[model samples]
Target: MLKFSILKCLPVLAVCALLAACVGPQKQTAGYDYTAFKSAKPRSILVLPPLNETVDVNATNGMLSQMTMPLAESGYYVLPVAEVAETFRQNGISLPVEMQATSPKKLREIFGADAVLYTKVTQYGSVYRVVDSSTVVTATAKLVSLGTGDVLWQGGASANGKELGNVDFGSGSIIGMMVQAAVKQVAHSLADKSQEVAGLTSQRLLSAGQPNGLLYGPHSPKYGSD
Candidate 1:
């Protein structure tokens, strides 16, 4: 009986070993390569108006307006956006696509910036469902060296108003949920909550200090620490 019991335990141990082998050590994620970005070490960033891929006409301006604060906070000098837009307009380069297409050398000469940030708005505005509604904003950005025209860094971020924990319709009847969703949709549209969400997205996309985020600019207190 003792021998049989030991044999049974051996099989159980073998199964556990196999299971452990199957669940091996977690793979570490590869860190972003910042070689180019580190080499460039830009001091000033010129943000061009974001290209709007969405149907919302306000997406470009909304995303553009929110970009400056975060980049400035990251310790880089952000050229005044209003002035930049007007400069483009005066030169007959009113479209974001055209602005982005302008040669990096020309941009350096015109704006006297060390680098330029190009952005695109992929999603914006509120979407309505039968029992739920939410505002979402998504964007991607790239930093390029004005001198070399090499891409220094790139990242993307998104924000949803519902996920931000600000939306609440209460746990109520289905009819009540529908009504609340409708009312919330109308309120969100009127309030243009997508712009608010864009602010959050811009912070995530441009802010330094976070893992895989932009390197700190010279203006930041932690500039060299990164």
Candidate 2:
């Protein structure tokens, strides 16, 4: 009887394994084309204010402020963001849309940048459910050559509080779960949890060594290795 029962469960076990494989993360078979990015060989990068597509008012500056360090660590000279924003303001182009709209030729003329990085914040902030609250940040970026006006590279990244080890607010009782979620939401908002996630997202999006990420720039010791 035991042997028969084990043999009967084999098909069920195989079906469960098949279901798990179906829902697992898919791997990319085709890699990104790096022809344009490699040919550009840009050294100086100009990061523009990020265009915000979400309801969060802080998304633009939050994402923009987190971008520089990763690019610098990747071996590119990232122009100071504060000075860049001020320059836009002085030129009467205070809106991110306007800043992004400025022609590549004009940007090169003004900043002498070899490349420009334009970013859009698609999601930023906390979402509350009855038993859970999560803070997430998501953004996409494009690197364009100033001289040729060709997009050299493009990628996106997203991060969440739970991924950073944020504790879950779920509870045994429904009422307790709701209360914990509410408190967690309030704390997350007060602490600006999304901004912390943004920093991690920026690192993943802009770091050079990442798969299909920006290639190492001239200043890096491993330059030309990529």
Model 2, span 5-90: residue lDDT tens? 99999999999999878766343334677899999999999999999999999999888889999999999999998899888899
Q: How close is candidate 1 to the true structure, as a TM-score?
A: 0.84
Q: State the displacement of the C-alpha of residue 70, model 2, in Å, after optimal TM-score superposition.
A: 0.3
* Model 2 residue 110 distance off true place after TM-score fit, in angstroms: 0.6
TM-score of each: 0.84, 0.84
Go through the candidates in order and give each one's C-alpha lDDT. Answer: 0.91, 0.92
- Report residue 118 deviation for candidate 1 (angstroms): 0.5
lDDT string for model 1 (1-107, tens) is 99999998998999999888766643224467789999999999999999999999999998998999999999999999889988999999889999999999999
Best by TM-score: 2
